[model samples]
Target chain A: MHVPTPHTPLPRRPFDRSSFVLSATLAILAVLTIYGFTTFDTNGVDMDMALDMLGDNAKTLFFAPGLSNVTIEGLLKNLGVTVALGFLTTVLGAVIGMVFALASALNLAPVWLSVVVKAFTAVVRAIPTVLWVLIFAVSAGLGSVAAVLGMTFHSAGYLIKAYAESFEEVDAGSIEALKASGADWWQVVGQVFIPSSRAALMSWTFLRFEINFSTAIAMGAAAGAGGIGFDMFMASGFYLNLREMGAFTYAILIFAVLLEYVATKLHTKTMQG
Target chain B: MTILHVDNVRKTYGGNSYALDGVSFSVEKGEFVAIIGPSGAGKSTLLRCVNRLIFVTSGEVSVNGIAVTGLSNPSLRRLRRTIGMIFQHYNLVNRLTVLENVLHGRLGYKSTIAGTCGFYTASEKNRAYEILHAVGLHEHIYKRCDQLSGGQKQRVGIARALIQDPTLMLCDEPIASLDPSAAKIVMDTLRDINTRLGITVVANLHQVHVARDYATRIIGVNNGRVIYDGLPKDLTIDIIQKIYGSEAHDLILADGDTHGTH
Candidate 1:
């Protein structure tokens, strides 16, 4: 072994508090897991039959899936509806969120306003997207309108935090330069802040869009919002057609991959530009 | 004529101690005044105060014969349009193209709607291109600022400042971050601009010899106050000691030889 500092002894690391705590936690979890399985809670259960059914279900749902109950045209229309739901809510949320983000950023706004905006957005973010949708469902009556409003509300909360942090990460020198040039507040925001943080803003917005797309599908079934999620729910629950459910899942997966590809390309383009 | 004046300026960062204590100076038009000081000697603060970038705790900073303190937002902005500022870090928006960043100097003269929408007229663009060419950045105008070298970036900063058609330019440690070679280029460019364009230049500099070489007048600051203000030839060894304190020994030794022209 080639030791550069051969005269000096290699210092040995002392056992630290965090390592002890981590080991203790793992030991406790291991004991609890073993104890849980050894307690013999399987009473009157047929293991063989359960395992067989699991294998059969997996094979039926994934291996031999086909669209028997629904036509490709119907599936495509529902997919379009879901895509529209996500896109609309994301666009609306991003527009409004940018305003709030600028207000919340310390460099861009007054301290009092930034604090207030941050506190309000924090509360909004603490609530889950589904709960917000349900809350709006009470007023808007559990339709596409409620879904749109709820998703947009949650997305704005999420994006305000993301966008504000990105804006705050901008170089202080750049901000000072713009201010020194006698640029007004809006001028600084539009020219320097927006252009400087465009790539980050786009990256965050795309992440939110992906989240919204998935949530829109979930909202379709839960809130009776019309989309492909409702079709999946009907096929699985009312129709008990696992093959149709598989077809819908494949369609969603393809769309998601395409969305991600587009996002990555745009992100690179912005970063280069 | 006096193009810039600082009258009895005092600044404190919400503390009992002063960052700038009763400092005063005046600059004639077309003069290149270099302010040399140790770190934390409030050189940057004094430069910023002239533009009202950092408001002084108590002082009168007048530029182009207009008082800079206590003006309304609109009037303050109007006052700022006639003055340009350069920074040590260049401070060009990295993601923006060189042309776009240079044109930013016109933001002060534009309407809010026009500036926000980036609606620059043909003349404004032509002036930007002309300034870029003068700075030797015409070849890289369409390239993003982040792609440029430090020397190139600083030139872009100068072009941005010049496009304002400013009567005065404030440079805070303009070449402090550059190498010796690049520093020479920046200093030469500043001298040329002062002599040719007749714009008053006030720059905060860390190098004593550089100040002596380029400035028509040198202001030496120590402990947030002006200790020496005279022609560069009159800045004797005793004055350097008074301005730099114990740090003067190394400076005098290291600066014994003339700087390389390269």
Candidate 2:
């Protein structure tokens, strides 16, 4: 009679936590280096000019309370255009990005198609938003359309990459089940994949809005599109409108904070879901 | 009448190791056949080939005498509507309600426009509810699939498959992920479906005892080849040993005394 020997156990490998720490440190250093290079400027500082501007702004601001009596309609009209431009560019970019992202997702596309889409997205994302804005401003002859087009192009590039990653991370088994049930490709996408990724997609959309809003402000400044950013540039150029420049700068900061708060809330809700 | 015929099918991934090698089998109109094998034995591949989920490299597969391999997309979609499948993982869209998941089974029958608009007829919705009740998940119809237990989710999967009103049901390790009692329940449910609906079932099972108990016929596969194909009673220690190799003893259930080999 032959007795069967017990199976040999595989050797255990110890976990190494150093790789995680090293990668994180490298990432932080990379960010710091990029920031340092971008902000590096070797120039003389003028303390007297800065003090004069601040003092003049403080004096004008103290007396400018009565300026609120000027037409409220003008302010409202300016705000309407800014809000519309921001919202429209963000929505258009999100919709177009979502379409391309779905086409590019590795799980949805054939290997060759996925490769083509990834290459296309990489090229699109390599061009910075500010550069796109400058090109559009010069080519399109400087208006709201230029700002909108620039924001849409740049935001679409970033959003397409993010959305593709989200789609790729959807549960493979769910999609396989839908296919096995004989659902057509579109039905599987619409029913299972879209529903499962709804929270992530919505969160991404909100985050994109925040990014697009800032881009819209900057693009408006570059293209001379009459938003808060354009107003800031004009005030800074005039040299006498220090109070207006301060107010516009404050407005931009407030807008950024508000949008960031909304984005954070949306992210929290998506994670909770 | 033969409901499905897989004729000398071959599948080779990367043109070397055979996932399925010249495998041939047939299912009668209402026969329940269980396929038993170890891991990587081409059991799942064979079932997927029936529905063309993974295309076969060569050979022919037909459902109800209609050839499936060469059919166009629309024709294949029509053919798949008639053959329901259940998976070991249940594979329910975790975010969707149980009712919605069941109703998805009707996508093949609905027109593309109607499916996109989600305009299911009242009768179809009624049928979905009826199947949900049949699978004993009527109360959980409104709940998301992820919240359900494994056994309950498998029941919903059964309901979803049943809603397709398929003539032939293919299950790939339907109870492999379940506890022993849950596995029994799932097997009993499949057996009941086969008997009551007169639907042909081709299931891949890991447990030999469950295969013997539920299957009218047992087919044993080893290394992408069908080594034995016969009635459940004919499955012997020698055949099990040949199919499972060194792991043959693992296939034997603790309460396998009924087969008279203890």
Candidate 1 chain A has its poorest 10 consecutive residues by lDDT at: A2-11
Cα deviation of A109 in candidate 2 (Å)?
2.2
In model 2, which regions exceed 4 Å deviation?
A: A1-73, A264-273, B253-262
Chain A vs. native, model 1, TM-score = 0.91
Q: By summed lDDT, which 10 consecutive residues of candidate 2 chain A come out lowest? A: A63-72
What's the lDDT of the predicted structure labeled candidate 2?
Answer: 0.82
Model 1 lDDT tens row, A44-136: 888789899989988888887789778999999999999999999999999999989989999988999999999999999999999999999
Provide the TM-score for each candidate, comma-separated: 0.95, 0.87
Task: List residue ranges in candidate 1 displaced over 4 A.
Answer: A1-23, B256-262
Give candidates' CA RMSD values in order. 2.6, 5.9
